[model samples]
Target: MHLRFHALATACACLFIAPTLRAQTTSPTLVTATTNDTSAEQVVVTATRGAKAVEKIPGAVSIISRQDIEAQGLVSEDPSALLALQIPGYAPSRQKLSNFGEGLRGRNALLLLDGIPQTNPLRLGGREGYFADPMIVSRIEVVSGASAAQGLGATGGIINTITRTPTEEGTRHTVELKYGTQFHGDSASWKTGYMLEHKSSYDLIAYLGARNQDIGVDGAGRPLATESLHRAADVFVKLGKDFGPQRLQVMFNRYQADGFDDRVDVPGDRATGVPTTSQRGTLPYDAPRNEVRSASLEWTHNDLAQGTATVQLFKQDFSARYSGGVIATFQDAAIAPVGQLIDQSEIQADKWGLRASWVRPDLWTRGLELTLGADYLDDESQQRLTQTGRVWVPPMTYRSLAPFAQLEYEIGPLTLRGGLRNEHSRLKVDDYSTLAYYGSRAVQGGERSASKLVKNLGAVWRFGNTGWSTFAAYSEGFGSPDVGLILRAVNSNGRSVNNLVDLQPILIDNREVGVTWRGSRASLSASVYRSHSDLGSQLVVSNGIGSVQRVPITVRGFEVTGEWRPLPDWQFNGSYAITRGRTASTAGGSLDLDLGARSQGPDKLVLGALWRPAPGWQAHWTQSVYFSRDANEGKFSGRTSLEEHFKGYTVADVALSWDSPWGKLGAGIENLFDRRYITYYGQANYSGTAEDYYAGRGRTLTLSWRRTF
Candidate 1:
């Protein structure tokens, strides 16, 4: 029985780490590290790309600083709703900007920006988790399950982000403005930003930024029929230099979200969830557009061969457009009838990559360290039909090559990591026709390749006098499938693309265990995980058109996070999670079922409190809960007969900050008791479309101001 449920979840994670290893066997003192330690044992650079030290990394990591993303981007600038409010099996937040099936531990994650690769794995665009502009983020790491030390779409782990640097030396400038509304109407939003930095005098540095936003509505006051139309603009730049130890950098970013709105969708009453609108004016197409551009060039060397070398070269270009739906059916005879509505559709991608790494902390001895790297990608991607321009996802051109190695050692209190990766990929594709419905299908592409190696082991014991830590890991992840939705859904006619064969490539397999304690006031961490794949890809819609289905899944989870500083300016935080998933159809079969809402999401809790009381006032509060799901355990994907479900909710938020003298001021409120709910992928009746039923977004009030000079 799956090895007795993986040996009873590894004996309940070794009885929850055996009383923190017997209270760390007679505590003493030790534990000190600081850069103003923001806990979780600080120092992380995406868990082992270099920098390690999140208790020596071994599963479930999270960082999100920069003052917690400027205090949650002052209530939602949506980085997938701030990583589903601080990542714990993240996934939730379909406030629509398309992160369709926003996954993390259940698969498909690997978005990065400061470390290149903004997902487009051969045309799988779930909008790479909102690329850019969390006000030019300055931190956000997250590394959850599967890991081959990052190569290929981290089968459910890795979110990088990190941008904003210029730590002291000269000119600085900043300005921000925000405004929000909908406490019960006008539905407003506004944002403006600017930033600049310089630090010269020989070791140069520079940074720049820009931001813009406008458009809002919801909470039943309407507008936001399936979201999109929150106009956007973002720009970024960075440059650096420091030759003494060899360093160089360059970066660029640009984002744009255009406008075009006419309104449509107005269907509600899915057994009383009452919400879903838009339909009061023009409508047909033109309303969603997206563009993203990125660039990078980096190099570093801190005495190379002895190790600490880095290099990066990256590029990205993305495009999006959606707003015209309804595909399939044309009744032969000239191009026009039978449910015609193709209005528009678009997707484009271009990625370029190269990453290099080397780290060696006495590689051949003394506490070992090592880490070598190589990665390269070239993606092309495509999809189209901006009204009959045809070709619906048939450009394809992925290419990859990875090489990796990792090793960490530290005797004394144990810490022995291991890693290996190989990965190789190739795709190609050309010949294409489909898109006039099975009758116009032609399909016949070429080249397909794959290779894998993946492996990672882990350990971390750490007790150094007390602070406690424990870990256990085993990782492996790899992905594929979405090769432009299996070559544009080739409907057979002398198929090709290597005879499709379900476009293989998926290999998960995670397993984790964790524990952490940190005291002086209180800190806690906990984890238990399990992931499995065996040919898993599952996205099925059928009549509403969405494909990919290769069963055999299994996911399991548990997480708990905590912090408490009784007083001393007060602090309290919390987190909780419990996830479950299952599936089957072959490949070591017998999973039985239930793995849906686009792969499980729901079972969460979070609570927070922070009060600084004086020296620059600060106050924050939070509460979130979501737990409900059972419409046959949520397997919706074109479900009909109206039995959709998901119904537990509790939300609250508040914020206040001050540190004036012309610098900062903030205010916030979000869904604070406005109660109107329905979101968790809007109860997941998957595409029984009506813009996929929606709601959730009502009480909101925000204000902000910042300045620096």
Candidate 2:
């Protein structure tokens, strides 16, 4: 059902109950930073916008600590690649500049920086995973399910990255240096960074880092096609001051990655099974690049009306430029001929948001708590043809206001929680004309508005003194489709924004049940879940234009995770996940069609081990395996056709580290066997083009050193 302003007002009216509750001895817990300790009581703030332990949450949530990041960074610096091996139900990593086909739980996952959304949902650029360098990150929190906790674009789940903050009492200086190479061709990379942290009456942190990479060679001694010969850098700073029961913090970060113009793509032959490669040559246009600048200011008060209140104001400016190509839609009569024009697409967007929340524990009674919050976002975005300065996708403005209330009640061994969120979003577009290739149709524009009232209910029951618990959860998420693509795909006359069916937002419903057990030296967790959407959004690009196809979709999956510590110096962990999905055929009349690889990925398994051979010496190993899948049913057409067959592949990595008196020295080996195989994306997304097929990376060795003073 649709919710209006009056409903939101009514929801906020419950805040009146805040005045009756008395302030207790225990103040609201705040998870402002992450630590290396693996404590069971470690808190997470992404799930409910408040501090809550992972075991207490009623659904699957993963926390990748600093130690985990450091170990994984030895093999790869890409966050998407790290998540692909660590998180269950997450799709395989493309290992490219864009996270094009990486879906979580067979659906889109939202990326956040300290609770600020980094995804450009209006355009679907697929570049959110590379916003900042992993060196500056303290930890990552993943919530696996369709959740409306942080507002729109969370159909699959949420990945919130927490940045490093000042921890020590005095000023500290640190320097880091790392280098890696495949030892084949010119496949070498290096990174250097410096950081400073200070704390006393006020806290301050600053970091600067830069990374450069040469061409990457696959196991077959061939250079990969994308993200080669690139330079990336970032600058981050944070300042905070505490004033009795309140605190204020300000954070800023700027990141940029630019590709060199010294390489050219060598398309692969799908029929001949030849993978795409690259060689030294001059590019037709400027190389692809990404640039982003973000800042946020937050204020927290612990004694506000006998409750804890948090308010944040944030803004971000982002732009992404893609490779140039001679496509039909880019052929502007006023600029160049249809067959001679080479143009690139660049997306530019600006976002501003305000978030406010209040947590009142022990509201009226013990073990009873309430949380009230609201979020406001304003985003304006557009795409343009860089060469001709022509507006390829007209400017569009999106604004959303969501108000929510969450309640938790605990009784002995049972904990129950429920939340309701009302979202009101509006899109505004001005009248615009299509390109000549699309008949240059004249389309009228108007404002389109949508409202939804989503709900989440969950419960967790712990067995008496035993370390076992069972939980169940049902949640809903709300989000809009790619409005820019829909707006640009209108090739017919007499069309308005409000009348387009493709503009409707998707509402996903998810249900899950799980069990967990924690022993003195071992722990295990498992869950099964099902999620569906009556109307789903899928985009397909043809002739240099994207078209949105709306259909019904259903996805089901199960995940198992376990860890065992048999000895004080030895530990082992593993996880497995299986995901499958179906959608209504876009060919019309067909039903229950299998989703293609672009929409869903195959099963995944990961195993890891940690060993401490002696004092200050340790080693870590990880193995990732993807199972084979054959969805080659029906005809190959867009997202509905499951015409690709994916062959399974396995990769292994190892890291060794030693703590010396001067610093910590580390070494790692990726692809220890150097087994030659095609990547999951290359094999599963067979588009009959040489540029689409790619080989996985070859064996590589990395060395790193870090010191603090």
Candidate 3:
């Protein structure tokens, strides 16, 4: 059964207003500029590894400025929620500690920090989105389709976060304080941070921040579980030096979060419409937690081989501790019986990489340019049981060497772009034994090597003096399956690590076309895309054993984004996206079955308004509506809960800010209508289990104050 599009009725008719924060005293605009002149451009570096105007990128690109970050932070500080609200093709946020089912364009999106990879593809614990705090970030660049610009793990797209830098000369101190609560049932939370910046012969910035979150209540005034309750902290520092035509910079950041030890879960009944709740109790072990540390050193030269060159050395260390589970793999005869053992899993990953690039303008003619780059990465990862001291996922080492080249040529109002990347990778594993539940199979391990070549081509044409542009592009992305999961659950009698059928790399083919129109006060863009994969990864559970399945898949979608400023003091922006996906029912069958919720999400519509009514006063309002879907009914043979049937809901948020002589004060209200509803993830991916049937947060109030001196 091929999936088909369904019509959605408009859910809201009332108009609301709010405001955003800008660095200067002027009011914020949805686009780059607010005046009648429409030529102002926003520059992005993630699309092609070099700076280029958004209109010239020849692809779908989105830039979330600092102003937008600060404004949304007032409502919620979670980066995953921010991205989900702003990006059109991104899946809805789960509002939890993990991003396991948050897909971009029906696939995993690679995350980067200042051009350094943040995800360990082999393990993919889904905590990569929490590496950087929004307060320390200056901007984020998003490319919305499959791309090979920066090498591997971009099967869907790319998201690169750029950190803040000293914009003013001299010494400055900044402080921020925020508080949020539901005003019921121990639901109070607070965050505070301090930053210092000094500039002279050398530029330096340092920041420290901490947050404490308590229990939460749903819209119906029911107490929810404490799965997301935790204590979080961040430490960041950057130092830079300038030497005429050369510059060097070093940055380091450490982020840590730990769950509370006192709370225990009270399972809910999905079939009876009950939500999971939490209560204070003594536990056998600590709760789930994540600790991440990253550092990078970059050097840039203006004149290297008659072109600009940049080199970066980066490192990341990550560890995640999961809650205890009673499973077959956790059994240890020496420690306890199969059903009596309660053990936890902890993933450890350490990565280091070196990336270098050079851009040469006017290669052969005035309008021709070329970019060359190479990247090297070495990653070591493993998973082990904390209590039993048993290795669940044996130690594995992976290394990759990728070299790429990109080209751009301009003629009159038409621009052409192309790129190619070749990646050579090797995986080394040691002989290990599977868990006793899997027949205690002894697996032989050795080295496996493979290579992949990906390419992209695009063209952008601009109409003469009309502020209109059209683009078409074809791109390919490369990614590796979760190797750690497969090696640990192998039940085969005589299988070698090098010959496992599940270890093959995935290659995605993407094709897109779009048009954009920009005016002094309004801008609109629309795009349609299709992506295909001969061998894609999916998680399947059988007989209480979870494993990875490779199948053929296809995803198609269309998106529209628009922004308009009917008046100087008021701005309105909106976006809509519809995505559909299907996969082959059998290993090599035709694509006739609908994809699961983990790969496909419901249609989303988001609208926002901003107003600056007074000199020092700003107001903002935003609303999101998810449409109901029932395309996959009666498809899973009663194995999963609907899996594709989703009930729709509406959410609204409002914020107000004032600038006083002493500091800036702000307040926001989330879930303004207090609509009682289950989250999209919980409804669409239900497993008929009480532990996963969760509800969205209730009406919450947030207050904040900030100052700089």
Top of the candidates by TM-score: 3
What lDDT tens digits, residue by residue, belong to model 2 across residues 533-591? 98888665443245788887788877766666677787777766778787865623344
Candidate 1: where are CA atoms >4 Å away? Answer: 1-57, 61-82, 88-94, 100-153, 156-279, 282-322, 325-391, 394-431, 434-443, 470-476, 485-517, 524-562, 567-571, 574-607, 610-620, 623-709
Candidate 2 TM-score to native: 0.93
What's the count of clashing pairs in each model shown?
0, 1, 5
lDDT minimum window of 10 residues, candidate 2: 23-32
What lDDT does each candidate get? 0.72, 0.80, 0.80
Compose the digit string of candidate 3's lDDT tens values, residues 659-705: 98889899998889988888887777734357877788889999999
Q: Candidate 3: lDDT of 302?
A: 84
Question: Ten consecutive residues with minimal summed lDDT in candidate 1?
Answer: 21-30
Q: How accurate is candidate 1 locally (lDDT)?
A: 0.72
Query: By the TM-score metric, which is better: model 2 or model 3?
Result: 3
lDDT of 1 by residue, 422-511 (tens): 999888787888765656778777888889899998887877778777788889889876778767766668888887877778889898
- Cα-based TM-score, every candidate: 0.34, 0.93, 0.94
lDDT score, residue 238, model 1? 80
